[model samples]
Target: MFEGHDPYLVALSVVIAILGGYTGFGLAARIRGTPGVSHRVLLAGAAGFLAVGIWTMHFIGMLAAPIPADTVYLVLPTIISFLICALVVGISLFFVSIGEPSLRRVISSAILLGVGIASMHYVGMHGLSGNFTMEHDDSMVLLSVLVAIVAAYGGLRAFLARQDGIRLIASSIAFGVAVSGMHYTAMFGGHFVPLSGEGHHHGVSGLAASQQILSIVVAVLCFVIAAGFLLSLVPEPRRRGARDSAGETGALAPETDAAAVDVVSPQRDHAGPAAPRIVSAPLGGLGQPQRPAPVARLPLEGADGTHFIDTANVRSVRADAHYTRVHDGTRERMCPWSISEAEAQLDPSLFVRVHRSHIVAIPHVSFVRKEGDGAVIELDGPSPHRVPVSRAKIAELKARLGLARPHA
Candidate 1:
């Protein structure tokens, strides 16, 4: 029966479950669609919040159980359980954050997480000390593990989908249920028997229920607060000018007036048949000045040789740390220049920077598809490729492609 259950501690466990679930899902969302060091740091913080929350909940639940007067928890095993939980959850999040998602990776992450949860539970149980022996129902243990696996998979899928705020909150509730259900069900399956003896000496001094509860609550609160602060540091997307804003489309913006054309005229020198001097003038009376043809030669140098590539043949230019990778329809070559530098040199009418890391040729882009908070540009060639569009750049890209007018 639930003889020793403290309603207050039980309520605290439920609160911990809810907070933990929300923090876990929030971490997953922050980690997705992000790259480099920021992704890694956010993933670590999220894993820490989840693992510590689970461990705290388990220990708090144990403290709520009715036990013999001599019962105590060994310090080392309890500490080990917490470490195991953190390590396992951290590994699972890391696997999910890198590259494209796949079923095999999801299953693998789930198994690792499930095993970690079961191990933490059993190890914590082993930490119990008294003149008593513990036994567990094999069927119940199997069932708990199965629940862990299913719950882990479901949570991962929901978080990875990067749904809206309401869906994320709902998934968090489901996650909380999964975690709490597994814990209480496992507890129900366990039986503790007092040894047949007159008296027993308890060597280890365990904290009183109140002290344990207070310490765990404070620690978990600190962890949650720290995670929240870190997540807040993630930068918001840059704000773009309205589509109707002047100069939004770079060179693609329509001409409002005839551009002044520079025309050179030869002047006869007054002194003794000197070579004719040249003077320049702006030809405003002429019809709209002819637009210059798009620049054709892209000066690039690689290990093989320095050459001028026809800009029309360039499919994309990707920023690669200190250098840029210039991709043609058939192959890619590394140039010593940065992407921004190349962007300045390229014809704005033919190419546009779609993301911080990428610039695509307008002619090569076949279509654009929205995904999550961003969009992807599909390029047409022998081998089609997709390039990510930054949230801030989406409007600008549309304007460049003549798909939408600039908005305020």
Candidate 2:
């Protein structure tokens, strides 16, 4: 029985897993920041990297084993294994990306991914056709399955984790180790028996039992992962904020990314805050069908149909994660524009930004009074609404309303 495994290949397998995890997770983190086509593309790319990492790790681990020459890999089974992994991974990521990832959803996604990965490994193992028969200890198989599930849990959590730089690196390393550990654990339980009669003929039309070909494939994939890793390390492009009707050039907001997890965009001090969260599957806010530019009427989706509200009727716009809530002198309705986008598109003179999360209209203001360190404006809509104003913007607000103190 062949017992010894190549140390270098084993190490390489782990390294590849880490690289792949980092690249995949990195791409996934940006899924919540971008909109529409870019979002879908990132999702596919992330899933592809993750599945390839898992499949490649399994294959490399197999090569590390001291299996006899002439062992052929069945084409169909090998392909099937990868497809299974990719399908499950994609589904899991998709689930968490849409809406807020509840605890139940996270656990369910983790379990599905874990079971799928284990299935992929065993199926690929079954693809080996040679002069030896393989048997696995039932206990060891269970242990490996458990390990796979646990590792998959970590991976899913990592996807949901705040995708900061250091944390991402840490999660990727932990993920890689756990994944490789499962592969080796199962291998430790496998026993091979030499067969004297004619060997398995299923691989006759499959892979040409050549280690060189396997090596080439692994090398090429590793290069691709490395390239993707480098690209992910680069800074994302800055986004230009929309120009207002007043023709005043708005300050550019930092770029946001869409993601598979409950995502939150970073705060921008200069521009109205960027709260570009990916709230729904395939995204509805920024991903909605294209419509005419919002010059006079701002479209709001209601339960029955799309309602376009007159911008002049807009009393105040409050930030709600990626979307905004508008008080239109009657009722508050959900608007898909981000806070920064609302600031940029709406008339700046009529609608002034008083706080990072609150925008107010001068015409609708019933009263302005001090509130603690900052100030609050009482809006005279049908159902009156009060909006908080930042202390920094109080002077500007006073000037806009002809209430500024005369120069000293």
Candidate 3:
């Protein structure tokens, strides 16, 4: 069976797999910390590209095989195989994406995706119809599944890492090689026997046969994957603007990029400025030392619509990627604020930055306990939320909590 294989097609199949893996995993990595429509869109796009890549690579590898000349592909099973790959791949990605990812979640997701890859391959193999009986070496089949799972775990781990261009490309190449290896491994384990009669081949109606069709299908899918990969390479527009390190709750104007603030000043009141004129300097220098009111309510996006949670109700704000998540006694919501923004804008008297990623409302602290070099703060909330305090900030946090022991 190996003798008739086209080495060039096999190489091309592997290339396709690598490209797909690169595009898919790269897209999935971006889903972290992003929320709402953007998050959902990225997940879907990642899954789609990954699935297409896997499916395309499998069929192309099949085309490279030394198979019976009269073989025809079944429509239903082929479609089913693709769908199975897509559904399982999507589920696996989502599994690792939600909440805080742990070792168990990553492994479980990898196992699932690996099994799915094996299933798709075998099912696609089963779709083959010709004047032959197929038999597989059970051990080789199992080995292929094992390879799939291990490779999947590696791909997911690479994604979990803080990806730079070099790592992303390297991981993609590794995954592509593993995926292609699984395909050929499974193929080599199976042998087909030609029957004395071609009756079975003739009866195989409602199916398509010919190397031409396979080539066309692979080409079209490759085109789609290439388009998606190129699109993913394009950078997304920056959603937020830069602000001073000092916490300021600045809102953008209705139709412009200029931040607008309502100011009441006596000197400027010779004719109170109505329209938001661009302040050349900080607002404090305009003879109005009174700063804008502290951020009283945190804006959050929920399934229904945008909602505001009173700062008084917020127990903690934890940084998630570029955004922050607010724990408000009852539940957690994603906020548009960065950790620095949250620390700066929140009232200093009520909220304090306990760690680079954490902002805790002092009034909500229920307990404090030391853990190794750092300490843990248990906030009073509907759900038990623990915020880690950096060793450097322990003293300040304790002072604000009134647990600081007086100097000797």
Using all chains and alpha carbons, the TM-scores for the candidates as numbered come to 0.57, 0.61, 0.63
- Which stretches in model 3 have alpha-carbon errors above 4 Å? 197-202, 238-335, 338-408
Q: Is candidate 1 or candidate 3 better by lDDT?
A: 3
Model 2 regions lying over 4 Å from their true place: 1-3, 197-209, 239-408
Model 2 C-alpha lDDT per residue in residues 110-210, reported as the tens digit of each score: 88998999999999888888777789999989999899889888988888664667879999999999999999988998887777657434335565446
Relative to the unseen true structure, what is the Cα RMSD of model 1?
Answer: 12.2
List the candidate numbers ranked by lDDT, top first.
Answer: 3, 2, 1
Q: Give the per-residue Cα lDDT of candidate 3 at 136.
A: 90
Top model by TM-score, which number? Answer: 3
Clashing pairs in 3: 247-344
lDDT per residue as tens, model 1, 335-394: 555454455556767887777678899989998988888899988776566788877778
Residue 387 lDDT in candidate 3: 82
Sorted on TM-score, best first, the list reads 3, 2, 1
The candidate with the higher lDDT, 1 or 2, is 2
C-alpha lDDT values of all predictions: 0.67, 0.75, 0.77
